[model samples]
Target: MTAHIPQSRFAPAEVVTRPQPGTAPTDRRPLWTVIALTAALTGLIMAGYVLTIGTWTVWAVVAMALITLTTLTLSLGAATAVVGLIFPAPRAPRPMPDWQPSSRTAILLTLCGEPPRGPAAMLAELAADLQRAGLDRFVDIFVISDTRDDKAKAEAEALAPLIGSGAITYRRRQENVGRKPGNISDWLDRWGGDYDFMLPLDADSRMSARRIRHLIHRMERSPSTGLLQSGMRLLPAETRFGQLQRSAQRIMGPTFLQGFSAWTGDAGNYWGHNALIRVRAFRDAVPLPKLSGVAPFGGDVLSHDFVEAAWMRRAGWRIEIDADTRASAEDGPQTLAEYHKRDRRWCQGNLQHLRLIAAPGLHPLSRLHMAVGVMGYLSAPLWLATLLLLATGAVPMAAGWMLLAVATLLAAPKLCGVARLMRQARGLRTKGVVLRAAALETVLSSILAPIVMVNHVVDVAQVFAGRDCGWKRPGGASLRLPTGGLEALAGTGIIALVAATNPSAVVWVLPVALPLVFAPLFIRFMEAPCACLMARA
Candidate 1:
């Protein structure tokens, strides 16, 4: 017998009612402490710049401000890591041997134009996993497609076996209205009320049945919690670039995430996937509104997860992250070009948050969340400008001590991350391996940093110029000569100018300059496979 599905409203809310979750006092001391530390460090760097130069010209002042702003961002990260190290890690939830879900849940796998073989296989495995755990009856799998006719036909074919056995249902939308978020909304409008919860998974997202059960159990216990985000680790990678990223995430990601969770508390942000969402709460609170303008800033929100999280918080439901959930994972970009391509879309989406920072009724922390998102991308341009200002002799080179201080501040988080890993190591051999991997990851990441900075600067500039980074799949390992050439030119110019004008500054500029000059080679290197780096450790 076909069960009748209750439809839910899809209209955007004109006004938010008072939050049903009462305003319990959240301890924000850690947040304030981090803010104060960032400000103090920024001030110290600015003061050192003034003392070193012995004069404050207009250019010097502007450069100082930009440098300090970038320094502040870096310091905030270091401070968060320090805080993370201070706080003991959150304990993972205990397993419930006799637990059974009292409410229905759905697993939503949102698809675009990607090939379906992998995701179909993943879903099949997931279904099998759930059956093994004896929880398949309480959950349903939905393959939501936003692909064109060609891709949709392929997806239907690939998913045919699963559908035929009633293990999964496939649905394709005629219009890709709001992109991924729109696809989810369409699902909610049709069958949202029939399910108590929904676990949204991206095309690349993977979670085990045990992890899914853990998240559901957490949600079932916390009635006021609207969104429960799992800690996502990177899947093992084949390319050096992917390996570096995975290793870094494996090593350093935990402390940062722990600090972030401590600071945000119940008003945490969301990453749009691998999260358990209370269907009724999401339906009531997160019907995304179309912004009044056009692409980029206007129309549908590109970075909808954070905004939906903000809206969910405004409507008075707890949004939390359980960093201890280690079973959830996702694939990462395998090459520098692919990384930048994905980053460009994120850069555009984050920039869109600028318009909504001061939207009515948002919690202060939610507003801060949006501001943080905007600043994360904008920091790239600020950093690029600082480097350019130094190269042009607009600002005098920083004093040796000042430079050392800045480097230490930037490297502090990595040091803390490494330290934590070493402490957790059981044997001398394991610690030695951890140290070697850390050293290699550091060197490679330092070389890659400037390239990323330049890419981000271009992304920010293009976004402001109304260039829309449309929803497109990340391209394969193809060299972009234009991007590489631009980097090479910028690096060569910076080095030549600095060496000719201020010979002493050449050393300081080498880190940024050399990478830019050799960007094409570095890109190629990153695209090649290397298993010896941190990922192997």
Candidate 2:
């Protein structure tokens, strides 16, 4: 309900110039029609795939079984998720005090392979926010840059003027040690004792002064806690893509957060970036074990954050989430490609956690958290495989059963989310708008699944290969919307063909057939950003 305009005081303090308007919101209804048609077509393809399956084809049945089962699980999960109310709580943070902090606090802004000017803007914003709250000197800030790139190094040097101003301590290590974990350790090893608490901010992070004050006040009150993690949500900028992502996240994000918060009870995590940690505890857990010498699971630990949290918990320190902690907001993937590219690396990093879930000394539930992270991305591939299988001709009965189960489970959470959005939008007198958006999103997102899933699969592979997904280098790609229509039609065409094999299913096919026809357009419109920006305009 709390929507912000171009960066405010408690908002993201930086704003770019307005963009020239191109597409109008009124032009979006055709986009919706396109989506509906594609969904109906896709339903046909899927039906064909089911009909092709018979008792004779064993492999086909196996694929159908996996897809059907996974989708069912997904659906069941959806059904249980309440739409608007879920936000993960790390652990209750100590109640912040009304009084100011008596001790000096250090804010550590870790910069590794990020744009040089980026941190300064964030720092300026942070400084302004803090000054507004009247707590500027109570804090000392540092910019910890880990530069393997020459340009990044030069930018770090150029940042020396900011350092001279005494706003933040600037340090660039000669060699990159343990990535982010190493950077934080380097700072603590040298000058950690100078302050009471060291706050770690992300490269794209800009927090409100009020939240920052709240964090410091709480830390002052409770000297026992090692780390306090705040809630993190998406902040995509001005583009159509950005708006849709942000809207979708706000509407459906709470449910996901709630599930995550519930799972992490008592000893939670410090997600490395975007949370505050006790410098003393982090320093004590030094010399983190390297991932075993192997491919994906070997070398420097990509998921060092979770490992560090585990280590902290084992050391008798408590880690918790302050659900009320809205101190900072992160700039989400700015472009579509950027979003997918980042997801690839994340898939890799999280998939690696599957290996260490059983590591010695990890809390019993620690593995569960790690496992859940890994599964989230993995579900994409499983969904993809299910679609491909139902395309092949085989036992119609069993295939139909499996598909029903998978779709039911996987789609459950989203359906619940749809209901939540409907209520919220209705209360705001935007019921008509919200329902239309939901219908459009449901169809298009389904179609876009294949594209996203394929990307995720590639990313998982890259992780195992140790391919570096870092850097801001550019790549050439055709100016193309996704292959939504064709994929949807082909997929649903297969479904329809299968349904035709049995005269009885002909009537049943109508139920799914309509959505499948609209599948392609659905995926296209489902870009959330495009639709949201259009509607907003």
Candidate 3:
């Protein structure tokens, strides 16, 4: 049973005591189907490696490497499952102390460029919702403006009275020192010491104030945890593309988190915001490194969260992820232009990890996670290159089969991933809903996949190659930002091409291509908001 009438302070509907027992979530297909496809993927990959290597001896080596990889993967998974099973995490103890301190939780809203609505609307929505959660008095809000633009400063000033006396704090800097991370670091240096649990708000992120309270409740109850990273949900229902992406994430994100958190149990972590944190621990542990260099990844880690997590880990404090925890929500870029703007920055940040992929401190799994994150973005281009190169009548027919087989290897993990998610989603009555959405996302992802792959690869490749990737912010914030052009076209085109794989050996096989193509669109809009709460929850 789930709560249908979500709590909202700005507009609270009477808690209509209603029962909405759902249909037994649909029976997802057999595990074997996925396993078999996985094997096919492996064989195909080995075939490619052998074809690529030119000699039988090299083929033998490749064969050994593939075997090693497969074995290692299986062993790691088995070990993790065993560990979790042996030391199952304890749930929230009864009577989670209503740690709703009257001292107030600060809603820290930091802004760079006025992206869509100047963060006020987001703050208002979140503030109202949080107030309804019986946290208004315990809530102190702040909107940090780093934009040196006089007009933007004036605009923020105009928002002062609306923000309410002391309830909201609008601090604008005449000289913006630390970009975003710097800004946050300065805050920590100056005022972060004041609050018990500060809720960090990004320009794009939004959440139910109730969610924030839940995070605080969890934190107060579990004193050792330093930070809480909430399960993220994208906002807005603008384009059809965004909706598709958000729905898929809403459904799968929790399960992924469940597995992730379960794995990180004692060694938990944080994701900047959408969750609450023990400000003291974060201040003591995570600090913006005195990075001296140029912009993007150079000055202070572009990927500050991972580094901060790593820093916390190094300090022997466990930073865990509650994959099941629902604490926050945020929106993705709404349009193609906006999407790529975000992508470029992500590429720079992820690639910066190349230096630490072999770093000493982090849990081995965190290392692997970071590596995979980088590879996921870069792999697309390599995969695309391999396919395009093979597709051309350039290589020998034998080479083609070899490449096809190699390509198959790459598909194995994804197929297995789909299966794992499905299994976790056992007894899903919404299989059809999930599958339909998955199918749509797949086709959409396919076309855009190439573009994103190449785009990210090139950006990272430039960084690796020591070429400058000039930072260019795209699409200013407004009531209506650009939407539904390149991403939709690219997504639809990509999905259409990959649709052939839908009624395959495995029912969920279709989603492999879904997220990539449709991410720009799907992630931008919140799809099936209500359904998302259920299946995704």
Candidate 4:
């Protein structure tokens, strides 16, 4: 059944309308502080390099410029985390104990070709939670399926009981026109008007009933909030690689999110799933525009969440993130291959944001969000290039202190996060476990970083070559070797070149080089379950 959801009209204009005087003020001070700090750190590092080198060759100048840019990027993250440590977003007030939602919310579970059994179980649990909380009457569940194969039939069969009982409304589209965004848009066009708000969920997404009620209550109280994104924790992981990721997320994610929330304020981002959207605001503001070209940079906006958040913000609706709300969770890829496969898709989508970065009438922060999305992938190539330049001795290596400084900046965020976790650790025994896990994650992540960088560099190249990494279900987490052939080759080539010419520099490069060289072995090691670490995690 369709309801008359009034369409809101918003066009990208040449000039952005300034926020009204009384509208919730965005605190620009933290953002400005991050920018200033990043600039200062970059300048200092560059100056130190020049002073140590005491030379001005053409290659040296180019290397210095690249280092400056890389340093700025690295320092921006560290500075933001430090700022978050100093100025945490105030805790959201707890929902009233007896509060009842006044508005209806539809939870849209968008499924692709993923296994349906897991999602069915999750939905069943969600239903039970909501029912226990007396929220079943206020919320409806919809299974919007984009699965097109025999799996579609299987999915329907799996969810048949839920559908038969009227617990979930199921619809499968024959044509996956716009992919996930299209599936959501289809729902919005049809049933959006009947609900006050919609919660878009990924196949792996899970939210506690308390969190859902909290989000709904917040949305009801704040009339202008078009979207509210909750802080998400990674669900318990089974594989060693997944465990490492989960531990890092558990320890570091909160601090980074707090910093992110502080700086973004009302102009926050949407991570697609596990977020609440005002039905009318999204319907009116977030009409996905098919860009005027081909794959990657054109066609359907692949990374629609950020763009949606941006559009909603531009249309004068507040886009907020409640970092204090931490009950929402999602599953992550369990193996390196699985992780890289997902990253490849994300890489293309984020690269597509390059075209939207300059879209007119966007808030500067919105533009920054898009720019950051673009950089998230592009930074890998930049980092690879910077490493190559430094290793070849094209850039003077006299600045040992410069290397030390860069290392410090790179490690600062993790160190800060660990420190915060330790401070909050209740007992000495608990603190020790946190410290050990933090150290293990740090070391393993260092080994994995180069491999991931090479993969991302390849992903960026494919996008530029007009190759689309089409939406495919991630492979299962089965252990295999030779996962990093390209990484192995790259590392071998670098080491060979260095050993043949500048054998002395090989020692300095071993930390990064060894990881790439032994990537397959490392991948296997990472894939193997470590009971010690998993128990602590």
TM-scores, all candidates, are 0.92, 0.72, 0.69, 0.92
Candidate 2 at residue 379, lDDT?
72
Higher-scoring candidate on lDDT, 1 or 3: 1
lDDT per model vs. reference: 0.81, 0.58, 0.53, 0.81
What digit string (tens of lDDT, one per residue) describes model 4 on residues 1-537? 111122322121223232231257677788887888888888888778877775578877777777776787788888877777778577566678888887779999999889999999999899889999989988888888888767877888898888766778888887887889888888887777678789999999999999999899988877788899989998888788889889888878888788888888889999999999888788768787788888867888888899999998888898988886377999988898789888888888889888888888899989988887887788888877766666667666653466578778978889878878887899999999888888888888889888888878888887897877676422322213357767888889889877886666777677778999998888888888656757486
**What digit string (tens of lDDT, one per residue) describes model 1 on residues 1-537?**
112122222233234333356454656776877777778777787777777885568887887777776787788888888777877765656657989887678899998888899898999999999999988978888888888866777777888888877788778887788889889998898777678889999888999988989889888777788998888999889899999998888778888888778778889999999999998789879788888888767888889999999999999899988876478999999987788888888888888888888889998879878877887889888877776676556676554565577678878888888988888999999999888888888889989988888878788877897877776423322234554777888789888887887777778788788999999888888888875644465
Tell me the lDDT of candidate 3.
0.53
Candidate 3, residue 223: the lDDT equals 55
Per-residue lDDT of model 2, residues 138-231, tens digit only: 7767777776656665665657666656556677777777778788887777667665577888888766777777776665555556677767
> lDDT of model 2 at residue 169?
66
lDDT of 1: 0.81
TM-score of 2: 0.72
Which parts of model 3 are misplaced by more than 4 Å? 1-54, 57-99, 102-104, 116-118, 291-297, 325-327, 388-431, 470-537
Q: How many angstroms is residue 513 displaced in model 4 relative to the true structure, after the best TM-score fit?
A: 0.4
lDDT of 2 at 285: 61
Worst 10 residues of 2 by lDDT: 1-10
lDDT of 3 by residue, 111-193 (tens): 76665364666666666675676678666677766766555645555565545444466666666765666777766665665
